[model samples]
Target: MDDEQQDGRAVRVERDTMGEVEVPADRYWGAQTQRSLEHFDIGRDTFVWGRPVVRGLGLLKKAAAQANHDLDLLPDEIADAVVQAADEVARGELDDHFPLVVFQTGSGTQSNMNTNEVVANRAVEILGGELGSKDPVHPNDHVNRSQSSNDTFPTAVHVAVALELAERLQPAVDGLVLALEAKAEEFADVVKVGRTHLQDATPVTLGQEVGAWSGQLREAWGDVRHAGDRVLQLAIGGTAVGTGLNAPADFGPTVARHLADETGLAFRQADNLFVQLAAHDGLVAVSSSLRTLAGGLMKLANDVRWLASGPRTGIGELRIPENEPGSSIMPGKVNPTQSEAMTMVVTRVFGNDATVGFAGTQGNFQLNVFTPVMAHGVLESIRLLADACRSFTEHCVVGLEADTVRIAEHLEDDLMLVTALAPHIGYDKAAAIAKQAHRDGSTLREAALASGDVTDEDYDRWVDPAAMTRPG
Candidate 1:
């Protein structure tokens, strides 16, 4: 290694198979990382798009060290130092050391090298060695022992996706489900007009409508959980391709076991390493599930906003929390801003799902070359959905109220109530009554009474809005 000064700061020359390159002396990354930084100035997205990827890489490297040591393939002192440095990376203590953009090599080799160099350099520092010196612990020989970017990058993607689903998205969805369930129970008795094709159809309790939203969310949550389960299979130990070329037979399983212990997640080696390396079906499944969830959320948000349309002119049956002004010019106007934000998040998730699906199909030959972008898409979807659910629950769903006066007005005014009179009177007579009421702007009760097709007592007993909410 050579030393020099540039930009008034110390710099060091680091060498790879290609040649020597200048890296900032202050940063822990080495030649490969510097090369990537100089070459792939493609996007603003770094490991920061999902910090969990950095943590996943750290956990993977630390576990690899432990596995290598247990196999007697690494020295105890070297492994111990690597583990310590890797733990710092896992805990986000050295996030600045990883600066590679997500748009690097399709196999994410640059990111893998980025992690290895940071850990190796930090391990060197721990061993009282100079930063650029590959003295006691070489990045490839020890820090990334028994692993390849092809396998380890996908493994890191799995780890990151699984942990984010379990630790962040699941809890947020549960909170939203609970909030909807509580509202359903609270509004159980508030009768309102049901709509079909945006036109009044029949009467249904506000509780039933909200309960349907909860049920849809519950189903979506189950799908997401099931998809997340598929991500527990890691692709480590498949060194260069799917054959486990340079790694020991048990290397993948050992690394997976260590990762499980470290993360408290049910990580296991893939039954078929070839499939794991060549395709990202698990991530695609997770992304599809997220898309399904986005659909559900979109429907729920749209329904909420529609129900809470206006206090005077619109549906006005449901009153949502007025957290902010709806417009810049219209004073005292509050919109369903949370619902709008959630719908926007749903749209983004849809786009991410499409990207993930298309990316999943790009696996050529023995390995998928679209690992980094796939990781980014799936992880971004998870993050956005989780945050949107939490915000929607806190700002909108929890504070939801029923406008009983408006609900009753709509329920009473709806001419579809003439249906109950059909079974007693006749379909043709009931239709006539409904049409007459709509044309003359009269109440169904008045039209039916005036038609002389039903008695006042029978009309009162037949067109009960509360009773219409449930099956007879």
Candidate 2:
């Protein structure tokens, strides 16, 4: 620790802000990173930036340091020490002690510095030295040796997002798929009219409609998983903007092997180091797939909510959970809050896609200018979507019940369902009779009875909407 006199006071050991204005002592981070926190404060959202991404990145560095040490690329002592410190931080041995400033530095230089300071301090302490002592395994010289901001920043982003998708997104999607499938089975016996442009004209099983949503969700889950698979494309080998400017040629493959061993993931060197260094398109690609999944989920959730509207007022078939009083001015008024929350999360995911799109465009010749924002945005989107899916499934979809009386009432009054009777009465006669039935405010069976279009026994035998929409 260094001490100095400033403003007639004794100042000991300059405080690092990672990027913001420096502190005399007992501080970390720097001026620019501090300035960023205040300058780019967006708005109070239910979902904000989180510590997991940063923590995951720290783990990545530790793991990387170990790999590099084992590869003989860096000093074994430093690598082992860095890995040890990182392991402590990872296992929550040092809670909130990994002092990363934030995602700043155009290429996250501040965050890199933050990592350097924390690891260096921890290592110094482990080596029987004072905190912040840059000796033996210097933070940048040894711990971050053979790496650069261009590659490290994006690499960490990939690791964090990929892990999150594997650990969080997949399980939630599985839950959603099962929920939809269960609903399909529950409503399988109830046949109803199918509509085009809200104008019903044919028969359909309520189960079949719900089953379609299940198919859509299952496909979306596959897309999400495919996108995650791409995230395993790590950039650790392509150092310093892909020129390998300061990196050893043999270092790349060794580090790759180490990463594969450490992560139990299929990590490998980028075939084209140039592309990996100068751009963050891999993350953009993965995030875009997530956005697509979010879009499908939004449609499915809203449709379920609408189809499950009411026991007396709306579509009134599926009954969502009564979590809270939906209306302040009315009694027994429950709303689709779970669906609304899912919709809101989808909106944010879509919005993050726009930012990812913008960030992609901003990647100039050798680097992208907006790394921190892009990574932060995408990470937040993934987390929110996963959380929303879990909440919606457990609180809303899983507990949903079917209202029998409502389905029966809708089936009895639906004149559009005359398409079921078409095979017996002929199409033109069925259409004419359905219009007449609606005008006369009678069941299609009664209207057909009055119009002499069909006999009661024939209506029963041929006009069964339940059988027409059923799979033969």
Candidate 3:
């Protein structure tokens, strides 16, 4: 493991007949990587242990290997081998072959190694041989020569989030937007009571209220799209502290271009190396925007669930699709489970945003060791919230119907219509009429007609719930 190079200073490298057989347990990386293996291993999980990170790391390695092609530093044979290995990774060829182990912790190095081995073996197979030979092109020296985990990890995280979000979240938000817009159009003709302070105050079309909700969702859609766009900014070239040391001069830009072409992403190099290496602010910022949208959805879902509460006993203006019986003892009972699920999903998104914010704050100086967990947390939130949004729209919002019978029954009271009479009759007379109608077991229409304040034609025209609830 000890050797004297040209300068006669003892290098603690372990080399054997096979090659540099010994790697530093703490930091095995050549001077290229910062804090290397020791810096990456934070936590581990079984299900999602290494798949995404390994495949992505391998892809990055192959992408960087091509940098030498543009820079004219590597031969054609090696470049072709690297490209082949990367193609395999991008095609998901090695996903099932490797069983993720404890080595694939949150630190990401072991996962990176897993990727290297898979790609290298795969490339070797292409060259007509067995695995683990490290031949033709080495995973470390050739494929991953110019990069460090410091830059590669952040780059891969952004790429994965951006790709997956585009494939999943954006479309889900669009679906919710379409659903809300449909409701707005559907309810445009239905007039309803507009409540203020939980008491009937004025008239408004139901469509107008639904239109407001649609507008909020439209804004939320914009917010989510913008957050996804922010993911396009990558931190790829900023090797070990963003100094670009040990990296080929033009390798960063060249490789970034290659990757963009390969992945169909708009990845760009970090403008500020120091900030890119030291902060996780971009992820935090994007997640905060997602949280805002989730908050809006939670509020909207709660409102809809309350509005669709009951057909027989409550203000049943809306009816959601029934998936199952809501109560065991009660017959024909169904709960707004879709809305409830949406509420819970939004809550998780909020919690994930909080995690991202907190993790961003914890990145002290040169790097964020919590990136693996932080990225996973936000991605899971996005995936869950997006799925929940789609489910809520399909199962709940689309099928909801206004309860005209309940509307008519509630309209029969007409006690709320006494407020409209206040302008014609004095406020005191209106209150007295309302109180007498409440006590004397007569409708406000009968009390008013008896008191000679209004006629039948006026009662029908003026006291109708449809007319009373229309927006001014």
The models' CA-based lDDT, in order, is: 0.93, 0.72, 0.69
As for TM-score, the candidate ahead, 2 or 3, is: 2
Q: Which residue window of length 10 is worst by lDDT in model 3? A: 26-35
Off by over 4 Å in 2: 3-12, 15-49, 92-103
Query: lDDT per residue, candidate 1, 1-472, as tens digits?
Result: 5779988888999998998899998999999999999999998699865899999999999999999999999999999999999999999999988888889999999999999999999999999999888888899989988999999999998999999999999999999999999999999988889999999988888999999999999999899999999999999988788999999998999999999999899999999999999999999999999999999999999999999997788888889998988889999999999999999999999999999999999999898898899899999999999999999999999999999998888888999988899999889999999999999999999999999988899988888888888788
Flag regions of model 3 displaced more than 4 Å.
Answer: 1-59, 97-107, 196-201, 327-331, 411-471
Report how far off residue 434 is in candidate 2 (Å): 1.3
- In candidate 1, the residue pairs with backbone N, CA or C atoms under 3 Å apart (3 or more residues apart, or in different chains) clash, namely none
**Which candidate should be chosen as best, given lDDT against the real structure?**
1
The lDDT, on a scale of 0 to 1, for candidate 2 is 0.72
Q: Which stretches of candidate 1 lie over 4 Å from their true place?
A: none
On lDDT, the stronger of 2 and 3 is: 2
The candidates, ranked best first by lDDT, are 1, 2, 3
Quality of model 1 by C-alpha lDDT:
0.93
TM-scores for every predicted model: 0.98, 0.89, 0.81
Best by TM-score: 1
